[model samples]
Target: MSKPNGQEANHSRQPLLEGRSVSKYFGGLAAVHEVDFAVYPGEIVGLVGPNGSGKTTLFDCLSRVQDIDNGQVLFKGVDITRKKPHQVAHLGLARTFQVIRVYRKMTVLENMLISRQWRGETLWKMLKPSHKDTEQRARELIDFLTINHLTNEKAGNLSGGQRRLLEIGMSLMPNPDLILLDEATSGVNPTLIETIKDRIRALNKDQGISFLMIEHNIQFISDMCSRVYVLNYGQKLAEGTPDEIKANEEVIEAYFGT
Candidate 1:
């Protein structure tokens, strides 16, 4: 097994997610411009950049949260650039936001169970009770996240890192093949940051979940991502292994500024 980001053993020939000349525009500004990248099955990839460099914008395009002005996004070998967010989610792609999206008033267990509420076959099938298996899955994920002790606790009361874990748990309820994690470490304490890293490694190794993470935590990316993509001013700046990325002069000028 490759030590950095569990690289070689996990990657297969075909990419699980691909962006072909993908672009998104905000009026006159090109927020993301014809960016191309890939995340292979069971692999962890990182997207990093200085602030306003289009990392999260690219995530939105891939997740179908924002309409791409150009190019295509394929997930699990299916075209998803035109799909709605929930439709993409149904097709085994899930994402957490830069801002944590947990329901603060709801308990940890309730948040988990409710995550499936959006997947109701019919939009009108509202306010229905959670199925038995759904509850079981929620409990299991809570335990896996080491938040079982907080299951009954309101999400509002938990710390920043705990909410991040809960959001991850919610994403797992979909049984997704790939998850686009948007800054899983921001605002988290050092201790909890380590916990998040360990859990992500376990999920990638044990459960076979592929990840495309957008992060500013440089060390976190080095430790978890096999390949890193750097974006600057909404275009891809570089793509390479962690060590190679560290040595890239262009990245140093545009991102590291060292």
Candidate 2:
């Protein structure tokens, strides 16, 4: 597959998301220590590191699920270091957890329909039946993700990859400017991994949505991201184009050489 746009072009655009000295602490230890990164508009950036390298902790800080002990996060040029999770979501940011968070008892369509429930609509409206327009939008997204046939299937019954796709669709319901995908390809069969990849490319290329995904699948990151960032021991280990990152000796020793 062809690579994403040149780094020169991305450098000219304001980052859709930026982290300045981002940090998180647990007692005496820092889970994420003063890491800085950026994802420009319409770009697919990869975040990769060994397990327990503070990647998800950084995601938690940026997504505002966890309070940072220090530093700031900005999205679309607006400071969001103190914003609530719902507030960030309202700002066109959405995310998937490393552990999938789909509503197991709900059908695929139901999950998608209610994904936007946290958008500050009236309590009564949320409690009532989903509107026709909302349902139609859900159907269209289902088709886009190529899971239309599973619309009525229970989320619990779906395979690992399908559940991941549902979670992604749930994220897309709000028409986000960026999505933080944590471990999107983990435990997924190879076939569905490709499917997930195609959907992400379609979302980025056709709709102009940006992505910052955490992945252990190096090949997936190599194929999808124009730029990649590496974290190790709660700090920025490396940042560059995929080829440059692959050639970094420090990154290889800390991450890939294991």
Candidate 3:
């Protein structure tokens, strides 16, 4: 919401999302090894890596989609390492997959409404705060995402990019403190990428929602993020401003052959 206060300050404050010495093992293989990462409020951090470098695995660990072998994940200022996926969502954490996930049977607005999973009420009372609140929020999100025209359209009938926008809208329905977007621009048309980026920026700027995004488009990364983290073979090879990453020899070696 506010222009991230700590960034331009003399010293940086604590991170909103902190992964401390996080490690994940799958059948004796260390996918992520003792990785320590952090993301601050109202900040967008790009996570890049080669295939099988455990980018997705690390994301899974943060969202609790997969169990970690060691280490802890802290959100805000508490340990959420052992929390379940739904538990994490209740804690104000939300995420989107590399592949879009939406309710094909529901309308675009309905798809966004369904993302409000934990409003907590009986079936009859659900419509009071849960349903009505979700509807109001979804309307605002649909307009924000510039997909209000498709509000009543069935989600299954929308294009790939529209569906992706719907998924993002759903993630925002709960007003999360942090959002993990695996690849927001993965299957969308080139024209829609800019729109998606703009919406993300708006949410970060207006709502103070933090973002930890995984993207392959270097140009998009340069345009959208304030800082970036590069992972190679499941290890962090570099982290800094876009210019710093662009000039790093190790990142160059990993992405382009020496």
Candidate 4:
């Protein structure tokens, strides 16, 4: 619960991820328009906006899930605008979707195993004894997320919150430098929401993983984020500590129309 380092330190350190004037268009509509964003190393930054305010589109553009029509995304000072999603993941950037994308037919253990195969290991190589380390790491993460009891259960049979936990565990498999989470607490039960929040804090504190999260749950964002960015009509509306965001008139209007 102690605050992380100040924004002064964040500004001193080069950003782990920077989106410079990034834009993405769907035909004539601009889903995201020339938005400048940054997530400093070891900081939990929040992105919030009304529905259709382009928060998710901005996330997609930054994560390379959707190609941008203009601007560049830089990760660790390298331009990753041209990188494919897998390539981006390989560069220590990982993300979870608003809609959980777990392999339903696969068991919890199988899902964890597949996440560890980020290097595109061949089936033969995966089945070899060399993957013991990989399997062990998977088990460790499953235990860390407290889903070890469901290791052999079908992912499809799990509840919404369980699937969210599993997907978060899978994202951590790559030991990513930064994780972009889109509505991570949505539809999750109150108890599980606290669990997800605790895991996020633990990851940031214990493992030093940075996070850029998009959430509609204001209380959740306020609880976890050190800094927050607001978007309205595909444009940057405000950026500051959560308190400043709560007081900003522009942000107030954006969410609760004047």
Candidate 5:
């Protein structure tokens, strides 16, 4: 997979995340074959494929939600293939699930604060007065996502798009270096989708947060991603820019059966 648009010039630099011959299997069935993927620092990369094409499976493997049957995953040059999920999160990697996971019963502010709590923090620490710094940071992120008004509302009361936005904000609570977003725009309205896209771009531009996104919205991917990888039946089918991918014969055939 050759990166275009001067990305090839940065090949000498280390990628923020890399998958080398990564594979995952469920029983005898291979959900993900040996796939090589890379996300450079501060880059917005897209993973697109038809349903059951292993896009989410690759995300699972990368995030340590599912262990790979073969090969390895590297984050910031450290082998994280064998690390636990929480350990992975602690090591500057965070991911959002395909299904939004939120504390429905809790207020949005509590949800955000809880996300910032480390694994070993004691109950007493949580019961202690809310750290002004943490609360302020959470509020700042909520405002950045334009959901500050919902700060005191129950998370379950939020709309689907709002929940998605909240989830993204929660992922940022940990200040991760790379975020794997699974369908960030799925089921979101066009207006909110554009907002999500703009926020993603702003995060990348201002904070240097790199992203690897699994998206079915071709136009969304085309607009935001500098590079993309296509999967088919759990294998790498192609890798290129959005225009090149749209024009690729295999991609068209795989998606449209043309």
Candidate 6:
């Protein structure tokens, strides 16, 4: 593996996830074409592209939501290009979708508890007093997300922005090393967008979690991402710091026609 950039690779100092020359197709349409991407143990990488530029498709391929026609994906230095979604999650990789996903009928705490169940705790213990440790852990996570006040509220009752925050919080239940977020604040009211962004920043700073996000909001990318990659017509058009990306003529043209 080639060395990461000049900076110290941080806590674990490892590439939590990597994609090499990855390509994907859907009935002859190449959504992702020979793209290389990586996320280290403590960093925020943004993926940006226009409507048909293949950002989300590449995300799906990275998260194992779809199989790639060619190329390799590595997690913790192991090839997981062929692993199932559940298998990938077990390896400490998790993803949040473009659309919020929660058990609408369940309370916020219950929704998170359901995800905790898959983290190796026994099903029978979920209700027994023996599950105190498990429930306590769940409470801690809810508190971390600052949603503990809504623990008993039904997930369906959350505002769009709040649901987005909860979805990210739930993804953390398994304590993943890398989190793939597809438009974490899409469809949210502007007032709550900054709150969500702040939480993400805090997690990355405090826990050293790696993030790979696909988003259309230019301000979001400019404000939050340390590095940004722009794709156009299924290929990378530019990759650099947010300032460099903002100044790139190619990226400017891709998002807003000349």
Compare the candidates by lDDT and give the number of the best one: 2
TM-score of 2: 0.94
Alpha-carbon TM-score of each model against the true structure: 0.94, 0.94, 0.91, 0.94, 0.93, 0.89
Clash pairs detected, candidate 1: none
Q: What is the lDDT of candidate 4?
A: 0.87
lDDT of 1: 0.88
Q: Which stretches of candidate 5 lie over 4 Å from their true place?
A: 1-9, 117-130
Predictions: Cα RMSD each? 1.9, 2.1, 2.9, 2.1, 2.9, 3.8
Give me the displacement of residue 194 in model 2, in angstroms.
1.0
The residue pairs in collision within model 6 are: none
Cα miss at 73, model 2 (Å)? 0.7
Candidate 1, position 232, lDDT = 92
lDDT of 5: 0.87
lDDT of 5 at 55: 89
- Give lDDT tens digits, candidate 6, residues 1-258: 212222224545657788899999888888899998777777788999899889888878877889988999999999998987777888888888887889999999888877765455556767788567657877887887778888999999998888888888888988888888999879889977988887887777778777888998878887777788899989988999888998999989998899
lDDT at 162 for candidate 6? 82
Off-target runs (Cα >4 Å) in candidate 6 are: 1-14, 117-130
Off by over 4 Å in 1: 1-3, 7-12, 120-130, 256-258
Q: Give model 4's TM-score versus the native structure.
A: 0.94
Q: Candidate 5 on 1-258: residue-level lDDT in tens?
A: 543222232446898899999999888877899999999887889999999999889998888888889999999999999988778888889988899999999999998888865333455676677667778888999999999999999999998889999999999987898899999998799989988988988888778888899999999888888889999989999999899999999999999996
lDDT scores in order? 0.88, 0.89, 0.82, 0.87, 0.87, 0.82
Model 2, 180-254: lDDT tens digits are 999999989999999998889888888888899999988999888998999999999999988999899999999
- Backbone clash count, each prediction separately: 0, 0, 1, 0, 0, 0
